[model samples]
Target: YGIAVDSGSSGSRIQIYSWPDPSEVSKEDTSQWNSVPRVFQQEDWSYKTSPGVSTFADKPHKVWDDHYEDLIEYAEKIIPKEQWNETPIFILATAGMRLVPKKKRDTLLETICEKVGKKSEFLLENCAEQVQIIDGETEGLYGWISLNYLLGQMDDYDVSSEESNDSLRPSYGFMDMGGASTQISFVPYSREEIVKHRDDISTVYLRNVGGGVQQWDVFVSTWLGFGANEARKRYLKNLINILPELNNSNDEDDFNTKAVNDPCLPRGAKLDFLHLKHSYEIIGSGDYESCLKTTYPLLLKNLPCTETPCLFNGVHAPEIDFQRDKFVGISEYWYTANDVFHMGGEYNFLQFNEKVKSFCESDWSEIQKNSEQGAYNNVPTSILIDACFKANWVINVLHEGFNLPRVGIEEKHSTSEEADLEYKPHIPFQSAGSIKGAELSWTLGRILLYASSMIASSDKISVGIAPASKENKPFVYGGIDNPSLSSQLGHGSWSFLLLFVFLGALTLAYLYMYKRDSLKRFPTIFTQITSKLKAKYNHYRYLKLSTQEQTDLESG
Candidate 1:
């Protein structure tokens, strides 16, 4: 049995898979034979706090707890009672747990486990083991495997194969961006780079490699601050601000008399102008008025019209003008979906560009300074740009580094040379060293497939999780041998050897210096005696030479 759990910022899903005959099934089949039941959804709330402070009006903690309980209840209801006992189950958890503190996450997990354990008792005489929280990287790999491998979306790439079934093993890289964080993982056909290199070279030399098959090298993720719901709210609020009719008040005191007065309208001639005013007032009072009033003014400012035309086919001239203004308000409402949460189509791109411009022009020095303290906050512009950049980067790396052909490359270009020549390079995708979101996921998926292939027949599998980047550390698990712990021991031994060597050298140098100083300070007695004897002999020789010189002079 296999269970894959995908928890995004907004929601969570639990899937259970049962494999009937392992020999007949492909690796991709394992990922697909699962059922998903959504577990949790984020709650929305509002509040008025102290002067500038904002807090959720509704209790989010309680809402989440209840949601989790409901998910457990749903799972219990769906799964068969007989299937609850002694089934080898795998549970993978991702983004949601990462958002909360470790302690809180543990508590939440324990709570869910307890609830599930209790429910399992009714189904089975003896309940199976409690649910295990899969590591983030593992969960990401599972997602990648399910999406690309099981879905057969990335079938072009060569993966491992089962000898018995002649079925291709699936490889994938996963890039997941949740509400609070992003994770990227690469699952390859093998962890041994040299082996993979040799295999690739041999395949290439033999011309065994097929066209359209491409290896994936990297997977990456970037966390943009705005969630879907938050994006929606921002878009809605912006829409409301541009609508004019929604802002119109029924009170006559609110309008300027001079502005409304027109020389064309007969003075003291009771006309249907009041009716237009009443209609406007009615729209302003309605629930949709908020959206209309906020969007209308901006629409009018941008509309390309030499003169305001008759808004309706047969209405009073004043009423036509009023209705035209109202139509502007209605036009703004049409943008509600695009403005709030998603960036799509031509208009969204234009709006996104404007937002980017505004953000670039705004002062962010304070935020930069406080970034380490987690005080740097993002608005819609930054978030959308970040997501787009990350997404583009992933796409670019997949095409370039991995030799993965772009989906539309052939259709767009008649030949390979033409495709390569005509491809307009994007800045984000051009960089080979940097991997973001989807690219990171792709890399991770490939790595997982590689690891799985290595231990395909083994009872246990060991996987090394690569660090996110050079700046962070990688997590490793399911190891029969812990290399990190051994590495620490090796470091300590080297440090001890260096310490003794340094001290011994220092002591030998000190002893040599002491002996040299002693030799300089005190001369040996034998040397002093020799020096005196030599001086005496020199004196005797001089005397004898003087006497000999006198005798020789006399003889001469």
Candidate 2:
């Protein structure tokens, strides 16, 4: 029995697979016992500012201790003691923990391990359960492989026919963007001749783009002055800015009415808004419009621009003037001058097309000169259109240009004609209708199965897997292809440690100054007491004078 635990940015799941003898088990029997189950559920876990910032004076663990406790309890309940002890569990954690400081991460791991260790020995007598945190690159490859297996794309090879088989081998790539970071990878097929026997199949390359959270953080920070959490908030606020006003007087009623009436907006777009609202409310008392004002400019400036005037109405208004004399030093409000002009005017496809044409035709020197002089006012829609074009290009390259194998018969023969040659193509497998948005999921599943098969046979695949067993030390594997901008951010345990320490010191200094100011204004307890006594004495004198005046009036 083997257990695979995949912990991603959003959630975590556990799968149990029972390896059985092929001769004894039928396909139906194999499928029944080897099924995956989701044993634990928790709120999507990711790194953000921790409550410990004020108390600890450094970045602290972002994961709640209760989450680990719940995980352990869930595992204990689902996995039998004996089976848990004996089964080799491959635990993989993806985006969430990668962003946190090393000290915080180490503390979290220790706490989790301690909790697991405290479990009753009777519950896990024979089985040894071990946890390993997988690196970003490894996770990317695993996801890639898993998606391929689930998609049924990996089984496309035509091994039966010799001539067509060579041309039918599959090669593909993947690009995945999550809330925190993005990854891009490439995989190529390879075959090798066995020394004494026949041959084996394997991958030639598995290269990953960015996996480090720091890189993503820095990319956003240098450009946007904030991280993913902040950028997402600004993006949503911009959306709300464009939303048509509702007739309702109550704000909550207005929001509900708009949401129900305009159901055509993408679900992700809604989620982005919800997440932004929640985060903003939790961190500050500012209204949605004010938050947008604070965040929108940074998002626009940081957004990648191979060409000029990258615009997204969902995040920024087109009228922003990054080059204005008053705005020159304000990095927070900067945006591509072109996007500002386009989004500020009427939103139409034709207007966007004309803007792009102007940009493409204009000389670079002239464009720069106009920008500096604050003369350029046209908004270009090319940036958003370009993003769509890029996504389509990737789809085409992977689906058609890549050498994916096709599983179909090349020829048909009839017994009556002495099995005479007739050329025809027949589908070898039945189509099981395509899933709408599960293409990535299918690809990831396929790659895992392929890698497992290769590893089982000791094949020399380009992608290497560190032994899942605890006896072997964890090792690095895979390469970076088409590196994401985030990958350029520096990441190291020492660097994180230094950053935390510096933050801690700065926090301590601020606290000390605050305390000193308070003390200087209030003084000590003795001085406070003396001041109170003097004020009481003056009040007593006033009361005595009033009593004397009353006595004089009685005598008269």
TM-scores for all predictions: 0.34, 0.35
RMSD of each: 30.1, 26.7
Off by over 4 Å in 1: 23-65, 88-96, 121-140, 151-178, 181-217, 224-556
Runs in model 2 with CA error above 4 Å? 10-65, 117-133, 156-168, 171-173, 188-556
Q: lDDT at 6 for candidate 1?
A: 38
Instruction: Please name the candidate that would achieve the greatest lDDT relative to the true structure.
Output: 2
- lDDT by residue (247-361, candidate 1, tens digit) is 6675544433212211111122111223224311111111222322332332123434222321111110111111111110001111221222222211222343343233233
User: Which ten-residue region of model 2 has the weakest summed lDDT?
Assistant: 212-221
Cα distance off (Å), candidate 1, residue 302: 31
* Candidate 2 CA-lDDT value: 0.31
Candidate 2 residues 289-384, lDDT tens each? 233234435333455543322332122111212122010000011122123222121112234334433543344445545656655443233222
